[model samples]
Target: MHRLLFMGTPDFSVPILRMLHEEGYTIVGVVTQPDRPVGRKRVLTPPPVKAEALRLGLPVIQPEKLRGSSELEEIKALAPDLIVTAAFGQILPKALLEVPKLGCINVHASLLPAYRGGAPIHQAVMDGCTETGVTIMYMAEKLDAGDIISQANETILPTDDTGMMFEKLSRTGENLLKETLPSILEGTNERIPQDEELVTFAKNISREQERIDWTRPGMDIHNQVRGLSPWPTAYTTFGDENVKIWKTEAMQTDSEGKPGEIIELTKEHILVKSGDDTAVAITELQPSGKKRMTASVFLNGTGSQWEKGDLFL
Candidate 1:
């Protein structure tokens, strides 16, 4: 049995850890980020990976900083044959990377050389890519710029949002990791270099990135909404409050109105004009201090406030 050190922090990483444990991998230690204060109460909460590790009875460590930390020394003492990281949320130090005999492997969400950062799954959907995949790669010092050991591609459906893609990619990554591990141990895995020219990045989505620019093309706005759905959602200003748009569809009609102008409002949709004579029909939204609601439900309660010719900034 090969000794392994698993490092990850989010719910996305939980399934992979579970799969490895169920398969009887000797997970000598699990390293994750520390508990974070969440929600209105600001209660400290453990990450999903930490919760899962506890359930599995795996030894766990939550290091504030890996470089020059006592936890790093503890991990080195574990003498893991391999180190696997999935969305660990921090870069591993070169010293720790060298500790694993079989070397470090990362299960990245995007196909190598493209969408190579923390938010690849969201980037693929926002950019309207027809396909994206998981990449098992040898960990390099640079961010996700590693030699690929294996990959598994997935199709991006028209209706797939960031939430949907996350679920799909999680399963895809789990299977690919399992399939590639034996070859990695046997030193038979192919390490194909990525084409630097084809590389693209998916940097972390900030609050600014989540703000909807109504001046953009309708499809672009639609993609932005879906990409950020059920998260730091795409938002536009309405009166004195922020209105988070959770679902939208691009309309190809010739709607002539100022950008951000509400051209039409019905029980089912709130059509907003955009640049290039295009429009976006918002189906789900959340006003500031309110829960997410369907367009119809919101209209029933606030119909008088939302009218045609109103502008959303």
Candidate 2:
């Protein structure tokens, strides 16, 4: 069995870790980010991957920074054949990468030479991609610029949100890792160079991007809303109040009104006009300082009067 050291910090990394363990990989140690303060209590909370590692009785290391000589020494002591990283939340330094016999391999959530950055999944959905996939690549000094070892494609469902797509891609990534690692150990796999021309960067999402611009096309609005679902959700202001749009769909409507104007509101959908000849049916929303709920439910609870011509800023 190949000896490995795992480095990851999110739920996305959990499935791959479990799969490696079940397949009997020698996971000598796991490295993850330290606990962060979470929730109203401000209690320290371990990352999902770290929690899983502890539960599995794996040796866990939470290093604040991996660039230090002491940290490199600690990793060298493990004498791992390979280091596997997935969403580890830290840029690994060069010294530690050389410690492993097979070096580091990253399981990225995108087809290489495309969507190469922190938020590939969200960027794919926001750009309205028809399909995306996973890429297992040898870790290099640069950001996701390494040669690819393996890949698995996944179709992007029209109704898929980032949360749903992530769930699918995570599993796909795990299966690919399981298949690719053995071949890599046996020297049967080759690292194909990525196309530099096809490379696209997915910079981390910003709060400004989360602000829904109703002036855009209805489909753009709909895509942005769903793309950012469950995290920094696309939002807009109703006068002075913020409203996070959790779910919406584009539809053709006869209404000719200014963008952001509420065209219709019913139990099922809250229709809003857009500048590009369409309307969006907003089904779920989160009003300022309130939990997420249906638009109708939100309206019923607040008793705030909004009419067909009322515009959302």
Candidate 3:
């Protein structure tokens, strides 16, 4: 068994670590991002990978920054034969990348030379991409710009959200890596250079991107809502309060009013006109400083304050 150092830091990376253990891989050590304060309570929390690594009885290292830190020295001491990373959350330093004899590889969420950055899955859904996939590639000093080892495709269903696609791609990558690692260890793996012209980025999501742009088409708004759903949700301003839109459906019917205008209201949903002359049905939302609720709950409760013609600003 090869001495493999597994590095990753989220729910998406858990399955890969589990698969390695289940398959009886020689995982020498696990490297993950340091515990950070999370959520409303701001309590310190261990990353998903760290918890899993501990359960597997593997030594774990949590570095605030791996490059030029003592943690890098600690990782080197493990003398891993290879380093496999999945959403490890930080770029590996040149020194660390050169340590492993079999070299470092990543199970990236997107296809090579496309969506090659931190938020690939989220960006794919936000762009309304019909398909996305996983790539197993060598880890370079550059971000996700590595020689391809293997890949597997996955469909992005129309209703799929970031959370859903994240799970799908994570599993896909796990399987692809499982199949590819054998050839790599045997020194028979193929290394295809990425086409630089096809390179695109999926940088981390920002505050500005979370604001609902009512001027866009219904499908665009719908994709945006779903892309950000279940985390850092898409939001719109109503009066002085911000309402996070958790679920919305693009309507086929043409708009009956100006963009952002409340075209219709019922117990089940609120229909707002979009810039494409179509509409979106908002069925789930969370008012500022409040828990998420059904559209009907909002309609009968505090949302009753607004009527047709009110703007979703």
Q: lDDT values of the candidates?
A: 0.92, 0.89, 0.92
TM-score of each: 0.98, 0.96, 0.98
lDDT of 2 by residue, 98-213 (tens): 78878799999999889888999999999889899999999888999999999999998989999998899999999999889888888889889999999999989999999988
For every candidate, C-alpha RMSD to the true structure in Å: 1.0, 1.4, 1.0
Candidate 3 residue lDDT tens string, 1-313: 6899999999999999999999898999999999999989999999999999999899999999997899999999999999999999999999999999999999999988899999999899999999999999999988999899998999999989999998899889889988998899999999999999999999999999999889899999999999998887899999888999999988876546778999989889999988886689999999998889999999899878879999988
Model 3: pairs clashing at backbone N, Cα or C within 3 Å? none
Q: Which residue ranges in model 2 land beyond 4 Å of their true spot?
A: none
Runs off by more than 4 Å, candidate 3: none
Deviation (Å) of 73 in candidate 3: 0.5
Order of the predicted models by lDDT, top scorer first: 3, 1, 2
By TM-score, the candidates rank as 1, 3, 2
* Model 2 poorest ten-residue lDDT run: 298-307
lDDT for model 1: 0.92
Candidate 1 TM-score versus the reference = 0.98
- Model 1 per-residue lDDT tens digits across residues 133-172: 9999999899888799999999989899999988899999
